[model samples]
Target: TSERILGGLSEQGAPVPQGTAAVISDPVKGNVSEADVSGAAGPLPKAPEPAQIEVLTNPSAGQAAATPVQNISTGIVSAVSGATSERLSSAAAEQGAQLTLEVAAVIGDPVRADVTEAQPVGPDSGNGQSPFSLAFLVNLSGLIGGAAIFFLVGGAAERLEARSLRTSRTGLWTVRLLLGLAYALLIAGAELWVAFGLLGVEHEASTAQVYLFLALATTAAASVTMLLAVAFGPAGIGISAVLNVILGLVSSGGLAPLEALPPFYQAYADWLPLRYVIDGLRSLLFYDGSLDAARLEGGWRDSLWFLGGRSEAARLEDAVWMVGAYLVGAATLGYLISLVRDLFARRERPKTGKVAKAAG
Candidate 1:
C-alpha cells in the first residue's frame, strides 16, 4: 500500500517515492525487498502554472488609440440606456483624461460624472462686527454727555440764585430742580437722535421707547446732583460725581451681565439707578421688548434677581418706577433741607433784634 512507504528520493526539487517496503509482524515472513516497494508506488502528478491579467497604460498622442474603457474603482454597477451611454462617451472624449468617471455594470450602459467647481474664499467671511461695539459707544457717550449737562445746569442754577433778590430759599431749590430736569431731557434727546438717526446704530427697540428710558435715567441722575449741590453747597458736586460716574457705571451692568460679576457687585447693582436704566434700554434695544416672555417663564423672583427676570415688559416697568422714585425723593429732600435752613434763619433774627434793643 502507498501508506506503507517510509522514505523517498528527490526529483525536480520535490520528493518522489523511490520504493515501497512492507512491515510483516510474523517472524516467519521475511522483510520485503526495495524492488517490491518501488513497483508498488505510482508517479506524481504535474503542478499547474499561474494565470496572467492585462493592464492598459496611457498611449502616446501620435498612436491611434483603441476604444478606451474607463478605469473605474470596484463597486456595484447599474445599467444605463443606449442613448445615455452615447452621451457619456461623447462627454468623456471632449473632456479627455481631465474628467474622471465611474462606469456602471449594465452591458450597454454609459458612465456619468458629476462636475462641481470649487468655491473661492472671501476676505470678510467670518469678521462681521458685533452689536456690543455699538452698545459700548452708547454707554461711553451717556457717561460723558450726562456729566456735562449736570455741570451746565449747576452753573446756571448758581447764576440764577445770585441775581434774583426776591426769590426765597424754597423758590431757588424749585428753580434748580426744574432746570436740572430740563437739561437732562435735552441732552438725552439729542444724544439718542445723533446715535440712532444720524449714525445709524442698530437697536431692537423703537426710537420712542429708547427716548423714554434715556429721559428717565438722565432726569434721575440730574435731579440727584442738584439736590446734592443744594444740600452740601459746592462740595456736593464731588459727591454726585462719585455716585453717578464711578458707582453708577461700575454697577450698571453695561459692559457685561450683572450675574457674571462678584456677589457684592451683583447686590450693589440692585440699588443703582443706572442699572435699571441700562437694563431697560437693553431690553428694548437688544431684546426687542420681549422681556415679559422671560418673566412668564422664570417667575417673579428670577426676573427681579436678573433685572428683567423673564421679559421686556417687567424691565421697562421696573426702570420707570426706580428712576421716578429717585427723582422724586431727591427733589423732596432738597426742598426739606432748604425749609429747615429758612426756619433756623427766622428764629435767629428775633434773638439778634432782642440783643440790639438791650444794647441801646
Candidate 2:
C-alpha cells in the first residue's frame, strides 16, 4: 500500500505523514487532483477501505462566477496555504519535513493613542531667585562699604597721628560721620545704576526707596569699619575684612540658605547688618517692599530684634532702624574710645614732667 506525504519537513527533520492518499476536489468546479504519495519501503501493507479516505476542498480553484463570500474565503485560504507551503519547503531543505494548520485573526480598525509632554519651569515662572543678584546687592555692598571706609578713614587716622593732630572732638567726629554718610550715598547710587540701569535687575520698589535702602545699608557697614579704624588705627582694616567681608557674608545667609548653614553661622546671621540688607533686598525685589509685621516666620533669619519670628516687614524695618542704630552706636563708641585715650595721654604727660623736675 502507498502512503501520502505532505511535501515538507518538520522542525526536527521528521517526515510528515498522511494516513492514506487523498484528492483535492473542488465540488462546484469539479476540478480534482491526487496528493503526492510515497511507496512502502518493504512489504506492501493492506490498504484502507474507500470509505475511510476523505476528500479535501481547494476553494481557491473554484470558477470566477462563484459568490462573493466564496471568493473572499478562497483568497484568504490561498494566501494562508501559499505561506504555509513556503515555510514547509524551507524547513524540509534545512531539516526533514513538516506540516501545520493555523487560524488567523480577523482584520479590524486601527488603534491610536494621545500622548502629552512636559515642560520645565524657569525664572519667568515667579519662583525665580538669582544668586548673583543676592550676592551683589547684599554681600558685595557690605564688603565694598567696609573696604572703602577702611581705606578712607584708616588712611586719615594714620596721617592725623603722624602730624600729632589726632584729637577727640565733637566737631571732628561730626564731620567724619557726615563724610561717611555722603560716601555711602554715592556708593548706593552707583550700585543702583549698575543693578537697575546696566544689569537690568527687576525690582518691585521705587528707585528712591531702593536708593535709600542701599544708602542706609552702606552707611551701617561703613560706620562699623570706621569704628574699628578709628579705635585700632590702620590694623583695623584687617579686623574689618575678617568681620564684615569673610565672617559677615558667611553668616549673612546671602551665599546660602540659613537652614543649610551650621548652627553658629545661622545664629550669627541674625546679628549681622548684611543679613537685614539681604532680606530687605529680597523684599524689595520680590515682595514689593511689603512692611507687614504680620508676615513673620522663622527662616528669614534677618534679625533677632523680635522674639517670636522674623518677617519681610521685620527685615525692612530692621534694615532701616537697626542698621541705623549700628551706625550711631559704633561711631559713638569709637569717639568715646578716642576721648579716653586722649585723657590718659594728658595724665601721663603731667606725671612725666613732675618726675623730670624731681630728677633735675
- Model 2, 1-360: lDDT tens digits are 011112221222332123211221222122111333233234224321211112133211111111222222333344334433444344444543322222111111111112211212223312223322443454455555655655665467668979967444444455567777887788788887877787676676788988887788777777787677767766776787787678876776544445446778766676666666656766666556773312333443434335434554454665566566677788889679767776787888789889999999
Model 1 misses residue 283 by how many Å? 1.6
- Candidate 1: stretches off by over 4 Å: 1-166, 292-313, 353-360
Best by lDDT: 2
lDDT of 1 at 292: 33
* lDDT by residue for model 1 (48-126), tens: 2222223342211001111111111000011122333444445545544223222323213433332221221122211
CA lDDT, candidate 2, residue 24: 16
Please list the Cα RMSD from the true structure of every candidate, rounded to 1 decimal place.
29.5, 28.1
Clash pairs detected, candidate 2: 8-97, 8-98, 9-96, 9-97, 9-98, 10-97, 10-98
Off by over 4 Å in 2: 1-166, 169-172, 291-315, 349-360
